[model samples]
Target: MAIGGVTIFATLGYFALYSNKKPEASAKDVAKVTAGVAKPGNTRPR
Candidate 1:
């Protein structure tokens, strides 16, 4: 019983440390993707 509890705790700890829920993205990146401002070889100040 004790070993089982320890294994469960270790698994939880590993998941808590390694899991990535939200990715990092800047506002500009999001905005650019949302608005069809420019395509390849095109640049615009928005």
Candidate 2:
């Protein structure tokens, strides 16, 4: 049980330190992604 607790804590700490560290997307990158998703047959009616 103690080992399990340590493992959980370590996992949480790793993510806490590393997660959400990505650089913010630039407008060009956003537009490229949007364009890919908007290509033919990719759209679904909402």
Highest-TM-score candidate:
2
The regions of model 1 sitting more than 4 angstroms off are 20-46
State model 1's lDDT: 0.48
In model 2, the worst 10-residue window by lDDT is 37-46
Clash totals for all candidate models:
0, 0
Those runs of model 2 whose alpha carbons end farther than 4 Å from true positions after fitting are: 20-46
Q: What overall lDDT goes with each candidate model?
A: 0.48, 0.47
Q: What is the C-alpha RMSD of each candidate to the true structure, in Å?
A: 14.2, 12.3
Q: Per-residue alpha-carbon lDDT of model 1 for 2-42, expressed as tens digits? A: 99998887666545533522245344444444354536433
Residues 1-46, candidate 2, lDDT per residue (tens digit)? Answer: 9999988876665455344333453433433334444443323222
